[model samples]
Target: MPKRYIVEVDGVPPSPSPISNAVVVGNQCWISGQLSVGDDGAYVPGSAREEASRAFAHVFRIAEAAGFSRSDIVYVDLAFIDLADVKEVNGLFGELFPEGRRPARTVYQAAKLPFGGRIKVQAVAPR
Candidate 1:
């Protein structure tokens, strides 16, 4: 059996949800869903693309804390509050993955997200 460890970030209190901030099992790191909520618990708002950037930034921070770099990322899952933002979201993704070696990605629209956030992102990477 592989051991799964939690990677907790500094300053942010424990999550109110069931997931750890991030988890590392063996050679794999799995980051929990991340939103644009600031440390102060405020949601940052902008065009969907901007919000998507913010969300990915948050997930990237978690990946860093888990000792994984963006290059190690192998998969990504994104959920949007509205389907209308697909193109904008993909644009931001392109900016992040300009070399076209983006991790396997899945994007879908959800009715809502915590803190009324417009988008949430989760990532899987090598530990």
Candidate 2:
């Protein structure tokens, strides 16, 4: 079995709990859900679209920390506070994974998110 490694980014504030942003084993990385929280540990206020964008950015950051890129992502999971915002989320997805190279995705609505965030995103990438 390949050894597993925890991945963390410099300058990103640690979570209050003992959860790694991502764990890598062999060539595959499992990323934790990324939210719209700023570096100061506060939830960023914005529309669902903006918050989703930031959350995806964090996912990309974690992927990069694990020696991968957004293009390496094979799967993505997104949670939104409002299902009505699916269109906005899809737009951001199109922007991130353009030209029919999008990854497998599962999107749904959540009753509530940590820190009252509007969106949360997690991804799996294979190096």
Best prediction by lDDT: 2
Tens digits of per-residue lDDT, candidate 2, 41-90, equal 67898988889887888888888988999899989998888898899788
Q: Residues 37-66, candidate 1, lDDT per residue (tens digit)?
A: 667757777788877787788777788888
How many backbone clashes are present in model 1? Answer: 0
* Model 1 CA deviation exceeding 4 Å by range: 11-14
Global CA lDDT of candidate 1, please?
0.82
Query: In order, what lDDT does every prediction score?
Result: 0.82, 0.87
TM-score top scorer: 2
The TM-score values for the models, in the order shown, are 0.89, 0.95
Per-residue error (Å), model 1, residue 17: 2.1
